[model samples]
Target: MELDEAFRFIGSKGPLKVGWYHILLYALLVFYNCWIIGFQLMGMIFIGHVPKNYQCTPPDGFFTNDTTPVLDETTELDKCHMYEVQDGIVTQNITECLYGWDYERIIGETSIVTDFNLVCGDAIYAKIAQSVFMVGVLAGSVTSGQISDFFGRKIVLHIALVLKAVSGVIMALLWDYNALVASWFFVGVFNQAIQISSYVMMTEMFPPEIRTISTPLVSLIWGLAVSSVVPIALLFPNWRHYQIFISVICLIGVPLWWLTPESARWLISRGQIEEAEEILKKMAKFNGIKIPNSFLSDDKEIPLNEDIIEPSNKGHDGENEGEVHQQYYLLRAVTK
Candidate 1:
């Protein structure tokens, strides 16, 4: 069988046949990918809550009811602070008080760096780490295309998951920033590829009528990911622990992997008709739906009669012979 045909058959095979199983498989993959968005939200939690606590200063005019002070230097530090709206919350942090400056002009960037002892080297190293991770993502994105096209999505996804799992362990164990960056880079590359390949596989397998909805529904996984990242981060606390959390999640994808059907389109395109037909039959049986008499008869035949007139298109007129021909061509193009 030709490569293109094989891919088409793989994608088109028995997508609707298994019904609930098919739904669940797609749901898990989509949800997993979307969950990455949650990781991004962790920055919000870090920025908002990672500061030290401080006592608030009282608003003016809280001294005693007396118009004038009872004693010249009797101004007790007012502990009864009243709430006052401010541009930003004035919170205590870890910065040591400067000799000349009262608050070290804490509103500005200089104060932040001075308070944190953050030098140019700190920023530089952070940038370098980020760049390494991004490079890994870019590399993985490129490699995934080749991997998915050549090896099939299921195998590629497994490979990506393994990389992700390893990266997580490496991140947890390594104390060196450079090593962490390197591991993260590989993780990014492989994880991203798996994500893309999974999405592509889902898009290919679903019926054309449901393609639009399925695509977005699958994308909802990203939204789910985003929503979950903060909670995941909170659960893990440390950044290294967060990596472990992500790794665990990736591991969960493994067993579900078996639930997925090989793409029927890909199978048909590859000329694995028997396998494709079997998958289709199983799908119908699992879904508790009956195959039409003609379809059943077609299945029973030893070798598919290439000349047999396929049944009429249902629910949609575009499924006429001409459109079916177009679909066949498109399927061929994808396999190639």
Candidate 2:
């Protein structure tokens, strides 16, 4: 029998019989993926934060009183330029900061701006780093779905999770600006891959009714996770430490390689009927339902409205079934 027919058969049993398996699956796929992606997507807000107050440092022995450079009425000692002071005389001549900048620790103790001295003339690199990461996200969104289809959802998800974690850690430890930018790009790529693969796997696992609700539920969880970044960022003020903290969270998903099953729909699509049956059997067992012996048999043409092994609501009538099918197709198209 086709996998869609099998899902319809099981779904007719009602939520009580299927809720257990979906609860476990949702925990592994939706909650975890959304949480990690939330932090990674919004991480730049803190990581690339520029201090509110910054000014060019003066040369040693140039200032005897307050180190603030004396500026004319029109000019001020901003991050990029400082006034030249000689023997306590303020000069009108303004010069680009030859010395580095000193930042007030208003936002956090340190960020990419302070760590790399990204203020003054080099400030644009901060935006460039974020833009590079976004480009990786764009690239991943275009490619990850096809990659997941060619490979399998489980393998792609696990691979992306591990690589995303590694790249984030690498980004944290990177000293050079170029290296940090490159690492962040890959982090964005793997992060998007994780999002796509997990989302697809999640929608495939649920029946049509639950699947309709699941999309919004995942979005709500993701919004909550995104909102959580502020408190978590406050806890880890240093950018490197904040990054490492989120990277380590990604590692928590590694064990799901063994804990969760591969997409049965994907397996059926690949003609691995036996493997798909095994996962379905596991789901039935967890959900306290049974699959008929002939459901997966090759000799028999499985009936669409066959009586479920366990008693529940009657199967949908032909007319209701058609409507359900229409709604399912509509949901599928909307999701795609």
Candidate 3:
């Protein structure tokens, strides 16, 4: 008999819904998504790009919000122009941030902009680096979906988590700009890969009746992470520290991926009958429900349960239009 037949037989004998074992597994899965959301949002923290507020560099003292070094008090503090007292008259010396920028630390410490001097002429690179990470997200989503379909959701998730963790940590520690950009791409790819795999497992683990309801539950966790990411990121001093913090946080889910059982349906579909049966048995034992030994012990012929499949009829035209009437007749006959 097929696994669905077995599940139906078990369902008739004992309840499969609201089991403690399943609930615990689902709870872990939800927690995993929440952290994944937080980690993804942390990627948006650009510490080098500090808040823009500046004044002309003073001849002696530093340029500040309240005060600036100037030759004359009459010349207004120019933001984009260099103030030069030419012939006792203030004149614009068309220039950019020549003396470098003084950043505001109100939101957080230095961003990638300040760390790499990503302004004046090098600012576009920062934007490109972020765009590359976004591209990785797209690539990872497609690659992970195909791999999970071929391999299995559990194995795919394990690969993704490991890859993401390693890449994220390396991204934090790297000093080279080019290498960090590449690392960011890999991190996006693996992070999103695991997210997709985890979501697929979440939907498949539950019964069809409850699967729809579980959608919003995962989204609720995701929503909570979205709301909390900004505040949590602020706790860190700079973008480097924030990156390190989120990378460390992502490691917490590594063991979770290992502990969680492989999807039973996926195992059965892949012809790993014994492995599928083992998970089912574990769940049954944990839930204090009994599964018949006959259904699991032997490969010998077992009688198929009749309740799972109802007879269907086709019209003379080879269509299923007559199915309702045929089912009605069968029901009436059974009632008699």
Top candidate on lDDT is 2
Task: Kindly report the root-mean-square deviation of model 2 from the true structure over all alpha carbons.
Answer: 5.9
Model 1 / residue 288 / CA error / Å: 1.3
Off by over 4 Å in 1: 1-18, 36-119, 292-336
RMSD of 3: 8.1
Candidate 3 per-residue C-alpha lDDT over 1-336 given as tens digits, one digit per residue, 9 for 90 to 100: 455444433343233444676678777766656676456645465543545654444333433432333335666554443554445444455454446555556765766766666654677888887888888888988899899988998888877777777887788788788998899899789878877888888887765656777777787777777777777666876787777777666676666765689887788677677787788777767765555453443543333234433456776888887554333222111100
User: 1-336, model 2: which lDDT tens digit per residue?
Assistant: 556556655555556434467677877787656888888889889899988877777777664223455455744545577777667665756777767777888555688989889876688999999999999999889999999999999999888988998999999999999999999999999999999999999888876666788777888888888999999899998989999999888887776678788998888778777787888777766665566553454433333233334333434563443444322221121110
Over 211-278, each residue of candidate 1 has an lDDT whose tens digit, in order, gives 76778765555665666665665665555556666676677657866666666555565666666656
Please tell me which model should have the higher lDDT, number 2 or number 3.
2
Relative to the true structure, candidate 3 reaches a TM of 0.74
lDDT of all predictions, in order shown?
A: 0.51, 0.76, 0.65
TM-score of each: 0.60, 0.82, 0.74
Of 1 and 2, which scores higher on TM-score? 2
For candidate 2, give the lDDT of residue 169: 95
- Which rank order by lDDT, best down to worst? 2, 3, 1
